[model samples]
Target: MIDVTMTRAYEMMVILYALSIVLYFIDYFYKQAKIRRTAFWIVSIVWVMQTVFFLLYIMEMKRFPVLTLIEGVYFYAWLLITISIILHCIARVDLPVFFINILGFIFVTIHLFAPDQVQNPLGESAVSEMLIIHISFAILSYATFTLTFVFSVLYLILYKILKKKKFSKLWSRLPSLQQISMWINSSILIGNPLFFISILLGLEWAFMTLEGLSVIDAKIIGSFIIFVIYLIILVLHRKGKLSGLNYSWANIYTFLLVVINFFLGSKLSNFHLWY
Candidate 1:
């Protein structure tokens, strides 16, 4: 009976989180301060509920919730939401907050619907702190990159609107294309170093624990590819070769590559599997 009740609670949490995502989107498009405020509170409430849920799981399992792939994703999403809330409060970037919640919602909803991986408490226990650090930084990098992608796309849309001279409430609410481009650039600048560190940590952990990792492994190769793309974009920007629409377009392409690398590479990588 308790299990069933907690299951229902979990579903309720998901529903509330999903609603918060919708409210955030509405706030973004409608340009309502009240709607944004409401969305923030909803996100805060759901974040608290998620924290409690994880605490309960920790008590029940007698370990951290990172023992399973689904639990890891949930925890990662929680971190992303927590960071988004902090940024929303400090920076007041509603569009980025909205898109960040969209990613969080998709991750948790997918975890709910997907088949569960077997709990490998023994293996999970054996995982080193270095490995955990690597994963945490990698997830953070992805979150930043997701923000970069959204801002770049927004820059493009706003550019189009300005070019067409289409004035609307949304247009008035949006930052200029130059400002959005700066956000994109900042995200990339931050994410690149973090992701680079994550790669180094991952390699170190692999060598220490698994003897070594294959260079050809899908995740490794894909990560390196992403790193190279990020480096290339930075170089181009420095050389004044990519800017404005070209800069945004490069980000769009990079984001697409990341999506494919995540979904496709994960499936094919033995080293990246949970169990």
Candidate 2:
């Protein structure tokens, strides 16, 4: 049976994340510094709760519990929150943290409410270490892409606001379009290499464990398509064919496709789905 105490703590964490998001938006639009500070503190508290839950979960499982889809999503959400906190302190940026926590909230909420299948914990030998490395890099790459997508979105929003001459407090908070573009480009540069390495490792694992690499697998094809899309973006950026709003729009479209592939296409995949 599920541990009721841990389950309650998890639900509370979700609530805190949601509350923090609401506070952030309120502060953004209202220009309330106090509310923004409160939101940041709320985020800190939420992180602490998440840490407690993590410790409790590890104690209960006697191993890291990220071998399955739900657990993996939860772990990723926690990871993003941790990174967001650190980045926020160093950069004093709020919008990215707001968007990240929103995504984290969604991820954890899904993990909490969705029907979870119980499976025995696997020993370290059950899954090869190489596969874990591949999956870790894949998850990190996805997280990096998410940040890039967020900055691109900020570029678009700020551009529209500037064009319309509707200035708000949030306007001042956003980085310039040039800065946002640079961040997007850098994120893609970092994420693409990591994802490329992940694919290589995955292929290595397949060659070693399976009859042969499954090039036709739905997940592999979907991942390859996303990779190609990003590669195109990188090429366009390098050749000076895309920049500013054009690049931002392309990122938005690519990110939308990525979201669909991750959330929907996985359901159709033979190997990627958790069930």
CA-lDDT, candidates in order: 0.81, 0.80
> Residue 200 deviation, candidate 1, in Å?
1.2
lDDT measured at residue 164 in model 1 versus the true structure, 0 to 100: 92
- The local distance difference test score of model 1 is 0.81
lDDT by residue (tens digit), candidate 1, 71-112: 778877887788789879876777667777887888778767
lDDT of 1 at 128: 76
TM-score of 1: 0.87
Question: What C-alpha lDDT, on a 0 to 100 scale, does residue 172 get in candidate 1?
Answer: 75
Deviating ranges (above 4 Å) for candidate 2? 118-126, 273-275
User: Candidate 1: worst 10 consecutive residues by lDDT?
Assistant: 117-126
TM-score to true structure, per model: 0.87, 0.88
